[model samples]
Target: MSSSTSTSTSTSTDDETSSPARRRSPLRALFGRGSLDIQSTLLVMLLAVSFLAAIVIGSVGYVNGRDSLRAAAFDQVTSIRESRARDVERTLAGVQQAVVLDSRNDSALQASLDFNAGFAALDEQSIDPARQQAVTAYYEDTFVPRLDEATGSSTDPSLLEPTSPAQAYLQSLYTVPFDDDFDASLAFDAADDGSAWSQARSDHHDYFREMVDQLGYEDVLLLDLDGDVVYSAFSGVDLGTNVEDGPYSRTPLADVWATALESNTVDSSFTTDFEPYAPSLGVPTAWIASPVGSGADVSGVLAVQVPTETIDSVMTGDEGWADQGLGRTGEAYLAGPDETMRSTSRELIEHPDTFAADVVDHGTPTDVAQRQVATGSSVLLQPVATTAVEAALQGRTATTVNTDYLGHEVLAAYAPIDVEGLNWVVVAKVDTAEAFAPVDVFTRNLLLSTAAIIVVVSLLSLLLAQVFVRPVRRLQHAVNRVSGGEIGVEVPVKGHDEFSELGGAFNDMSRSLKVKQDLIDEQRRENDRLLRTLMPEAMAKRYKEGEETIAEDHTDVAVVYADVAGFDDFSRGMRSGERLALLDGLWRSFDEAAERLGVEKVRSSQQGYLASCGLTVPRIDNARRVVDFTLELEGILERFNATNSSRVALRAGIDTGQVTSGLVGRTSMVYDMWGDAVTLAHRVQDVSSQAGIYATERVVQKIGDGVPAVDSGTVTTQSGEQRVFRLERPAA
Candidate 1:
């Protein structure tokens, strides 16, 4: 309709002024006859019409396209932002439920009672001075370096050691001996240490570790009524120390512990925002605590370290930005009330150098970015000083275009996360450069086309208005479609005139637009492929298909925890190259044995090896198979010892029970397993001082005479006493 009206208007004006006298009369009336020739009059009339049409059409097209792109960008981010906000709230709610439930459970009550008794018992007796010094040395020599690595701070080792004698004694048993293997500290509940506190920990520690593993918590702590950290699942430097006033007296844990103490009801829970936790080596840590009692008179506090990875996974969409409909530069993150990030930054993972440079450009200190990169986290590190963060923190919800933390202009959707006891905001943003790229291309092409139309109309008007008007109208209509986001719209070419050339250029532009769109689609596909490269094809597919949390519970599985005895001493006398080679060869042999015996290797570090059967693939004889796998490991290490002329021996533990396995991280996905089976295996392995294969009663029953075994002493655990057996080589 617009095209017909425009063409008719042009035709009527041309017809009325076709005669030179008529045209010259208007020109003379407008400006004197000698001021403009007939040809000049025609040229001016044509230029006015073409310029008006171009300006009106170009203005409408640009505004429409810009608004469309803006709306789409806002919608994309808003959807993701809302989803992330919901997930965050749901996650926190789950944590709250876990805290409240665990706090009221019999296990927590028993643990508090047992631990308090054990703590009081220790306080009554004097600890060995040498053992207390060893605990102090462990913090100074071992814990401080690990803390320094995570927080990028030179903390005083002297200030970190516990002051209380009982705290020192507990640390000596749990953390001091496992200085080389920090993660092992939590698992070695049955440390073969003759201490009543050790027995208390062995009895109840598995419950906490299993909870942490199942729920993906960083740690779980039990504080007595007097504010002593009587039990810690990870057995960090915090255990046995009083949170009311201790070495970590001023930390977030203390603050939360105080909050829990004030809560009048058992169901009452408190959550603290992420802060640098001293015990976790200054790693960004948040806590959720509830009173552990049946009524208003609280017995103690039960706190769980909030797993930041779970938050990061939800916020970052497992680092699958494109999968979350966020283009390459788009990301979702949490901003605490402090205006610092509470989740991982997408740029910090994809391009750390770029993240550092951009953040530095945006008024962040160079050292801050360096620390963020060093720690491989943005939580409580990256400052988000954007308008969106400000508004969201103030409880406002909206989507707008503004400068991001990195100073990039972004379309951001911001809202406060509606989690109780948390003052956090969720912001999903994408750079405008990426979001409005199509609109930008449209704008540039529209301007150039309008300019070309005006120039071509000037010359063509003098020839014949009617002769070229139709072609110009055709080009204008095609431009209208292209401006409305109709890529690949082509104008039909007639003769090889200048108008035809214009038509050809339009076709080329349309084709270019199509190609760019295809490239963007291809890039998204490439991103999916990249995710596949990081994990198994099945898991990647499941993740791509939008399963937010991938986890499985296997009813029957065998887990093995193996560590090479005398490795530290053996490697101490060798060069770095030889040391690494020996470790590599040992691990390689373990892996090869696992593969041959159909046992899946979960993970292996220099400190220990973990493998499982009936986890990935179910097997009825999983326990027997894992026992065989450990026996094979013994043979491999024997051969390895002969080859290297070393005296290293294998100390392994095996158990069969239910286990849960899942992917744990976002940027670096890890397939890991946890449950009673894994816990018992680790505990049993650490219970014996001898270098041999140990199996729990469950494994012993499953293998039934298949592998020769002798009775290993029973270890008291959370589940009464568990009989352990030592596997012996066949009498060949």
Candidate 2:
């Protein structure tokens, strides 16, 4: 009994394991036919499509957003740049006006004019050698004294009061030229290494030193038109250090002098470099040159130099001005046209050679330079420069780009500085990564959020697919039922959102579909009615099916034309309602007759009707039909003429021709016949003598020879074409 029980228990265990109702083996489920879950596959596809759609939309949104941001930034930058440039231009204009006013107040100019007037006032006899010498001395020395006495120090204040040491020195020099002994002494010293001139030069140097101190400049240099440094603010510097001596001195000073000379001629301003002086002084300096003379000629250049730190202080004074906006940082530099570093920030000044080398290495395109100067506005999205000089020369007020400047990517801005007489370009630069750091952060966060949203949507789609499978299956069955003509199948709607609205719309659509089906049946019957009126039912059906119907050719077809006389006057007198009614009545009558005669009505115009016979129903007696039509029309008109107060009449012209007739015009097809016979028929109606039937010669011959007619003389049309016609009556 124990052995049998153990064997039964083992069999029971095996039966339980192998039972068909037990959970199916995962391996068999995976490998079995028809085992793939369609619902799960559809869910995966939906998730994939949604993810791809999200990515596409996000990518487009990101690009468009970035472009819009960049464009707005560029516009803002451009406006600010233009505003700054206008301010600079206005300031420069004020300085120019001041200079011009000052030039007119020049004492030397007034004195020379007075001297000329005084000399012109004197006779030629009074201009002898002794007299001339006396006059010259008196005019040079005493004339100024007399003027001072007469004006009482108020006539010309800048000259009368020596406000500056330079003015004082100039005053003293004016008296020396008038003093005979001092002039002789200067000539004697000129022969002896210019000792007398040296004293004057020393005085001038002292004056420059005092002026430099007063003006708050670190150094000042006075340059002649020949590029000679005649005076230096620093003491013990040689008076005659010709700028043309050494290569460094020659090239840089020559460039500065040339720029200064050019500025003077135009009463403009420019920046220049100290060159050899930069290395010697252990600090670089820039010179700002302005002209000092009044009429026609410029005397010399007054150049002042300040430490670069001064400019730095000015640029950084307002933090708000420099900040620009988010993700931007900057540094400023002042440079001359020769690409020489003038004044710059501490960083650039400390590494002079490096910055200078960078500036000198690059060149600016001519078109960009012209635009920068001419428009005086900022350019954004311009190509970044590898060098400081190139950045300045390119003329953009701001630039944001990744570039290898001194072997590093940098963002830069170069603003033009229009100091009174200075042509300086200010460049600001920063590390590219530092400037664009905020953008990178924003972009990264945006991408991360987008990725998270996509993942959530994909997971949500799987859950939603399982939840909606049964409801969607029911909706699919209902849709199939509706499509298969099982109407009024109620679909259960559970939601209150768009899905509920969709259910309501589906119910309405079902009702509308039934109504539309009934209407279509009624329309088919109505279309058959319209077809019988238009043509034979069979032909109309063929036309409705888009089959082209070739009209059969008929020889000797009868064409009739009738037109209203004095219709323009009648139309003008009649009300629009009356006119329309009249036209409707006339066309209806014409159309009825045409249908009864089995004739094809070609076209009807505003004041006329045209019909053709023997086209659809070809008959050898087309002329006889035409004559019958004319007599019938005459009888209709005669009855109207007896009863009408308007006395309107219809004139009919008939012609028979072998012509090709077909519908013309794609959108509004109208039957028309084209041939010389058609033209002659129209001419016969136009040139007819009275309101009666006029027939062309060909039409007359076609009607039987027994037909009675009166010969109308040949009439010449407007184009000088002769057409013979006759008034015809049907055989009596």
Candidate 3:
């Protein structure tokens, strides 16, 4: 019985110990004692967050990088295009300037003047009966004999026959003494005095020679006022034949002459590929012409005929960019204004029809070629030869683009060549894929680098989450306490790392946020004060929201332009501050008067002030506004004259005009007016002499018959000449 009792006690003790151990094991598992479930879950969340962060960062970086690179590339292209354009413009400017300078030279002008004077004097003197008879005899006998000796013919031959240099030289000499029939044949005895004839010949020859020498060009044909070639350095061509006889003779010289007469500036090219002479010559030439004159008068046109080869060399020369692995590779072709290829490589030159056949077949070309011809630069990626051709015709540079040219995608650059009188476009093209090869390589490398980093970051996120979960939980609790208004809650710094800094920062941020909120409230009050000072509450709020106030046009507006005489000199001598003060004082007084008159002051500058009436309020008496303003300005000046020794008087000119007043410039806004009426008002002010007020005829009419105006004659401006009248107060 004792043995049975002992066995039952042992069994109950074992059961009690085993039950507690089983329950403790399950509790430990739930709280992450042995299993890595808690760590694993935290790690998975961290990796997912890291992966999202990496993708976001990588995408943002790629987009930013791509945009930056694209901007840089576009900038590079713009710089290159602008540089080339400027160079071309500058070259044209230089040629124009040179021609003007040549025309203005004392020697050239004096020579031309002397020649005309000499002819006039000769006409008067050579009209005497005795001299006339002598000239008539000289022309029939001595002149004809000399002409036959020089030209090897008695009568003038048809211009159809090819001319010889000797004949041309003789013709030039013969025209000297043949001013009249009497002068041509008249001859004194060899033994008698020959001074007049010899002197006349020498003077004539010298004038012609000097004039020819001044036009120092070989490929150019120099025409006289009559459109006849006076001289040609090339092939020794003479000008006795009509202009229609020459290759480009039928082309209108009148157009060039008219352009030269109207504008002192002349830099233009003409095309003539369809002309009879062009095809006969085998290569079309460009004709570039510039007016030879100063601002005074158009002397003559200086034209040059440049061959295609000359232009080709200039367009394709090797430079710094060419050596830097950025060389442009393509076939260059010259096309006429008619869209016909003028010149190309020998192979393409023989087959001009196939110049841009692939692009033309696709029918996707815009009016890019036409725009290029007109504006001088039009970038296009189209499959059309006509497009490029049209651009050349408009005197513009163009680019031809296509996904494939004969099965190869191409990017072409076209430049207009204005040679002589011809319009030719130079096209350079290369494979598009090859051109962007570098960019592709860079993009691939970037993507690969980003992928590698993402993988590495994902693995590192797992380890980091495992190491910092306990510390992070403690920090989170501290942050919550601080956020709940528990000040001075200490967050334990477990490591000298970002987590420790983050804990301290969070504590500081809580304090800072409260201070910042208070400061923000104070700033809002300050801003309200400023807003009240600048504008009404409603208007200020609307302005803050970036809403623009609509402005109505004032029909009965009185436009005023006030200018100071000798202000230009004052500005030059005085310091900027003193000048500013003077201007400010004048403007302040003007502004006060404008406010009283219910007018809106538009703009003010160092030169003058411009203002308008009936902008804020409807004007009942627009004429009265002008009169009152003028009188008020005079009174102010009179007061100034008494007080200040150095008196500054303002000249106020007034006129009535329709005005659309509105604010301009976002940062520094100003009210301004646009249209012809406003311009006319300003011009009226400009025409005023000293302190006088000049008004246009329209303004004077509006003032009624009561206000007398003195006729001020007419003033001419870019708009047109206008009859101006001087405005003054009626004698009282």
Highest lDDT against the true fold, candidate: 1
Candidate 1 local lDDT, residue 461: 72
For model 3, what is the alpha-carbon lDDT of residue 7?
7
Error of 2 at 427 (Å): 4.3
**RMSD in angstroms between candidate 3 and the native structure over all alpha carbons:** 56.6
In the range 1-732, model 2's lDDT, one tens digit per residue, is 000000000001232134442323432343233644546777878888887888888788777766665554444444444444454446345434433343233542332233223222321222234433443344345544544443234233222232222222322333324342322322221112223333444334344444445545555545555554444444212122345442235444456657766764535555543332321222344455555456557655555554444444444333334454422334444455655444333323334334434423434344433332332211211123346456555564555554533345665545666664455565555555665454566578668878888888878887787675655555556666655556566577787866566667767876786677577656666756654444434444554555554343557778877776655565677898988777666667777666665666666666566677876667877777776666666666556456554566677677777666543444443345656455656657756557667787767777757567776656564546554565555556
Query: What is candidate 1's TM-score against the reference?
Result: 0.55
TM-scores of all candidate predictions against the true structure: 0.55, 0.37, 0.38
RMSD of each: 65.9, 39.8, 56.6
lDDT for model 1, please: 0.82
Worst 10 residues of 1 by lDDT: 1-10
The clash tally of candidate 1 reads 0
Q: Which of candidates 1 and 3 reaches a greater lDDT?
A: 1
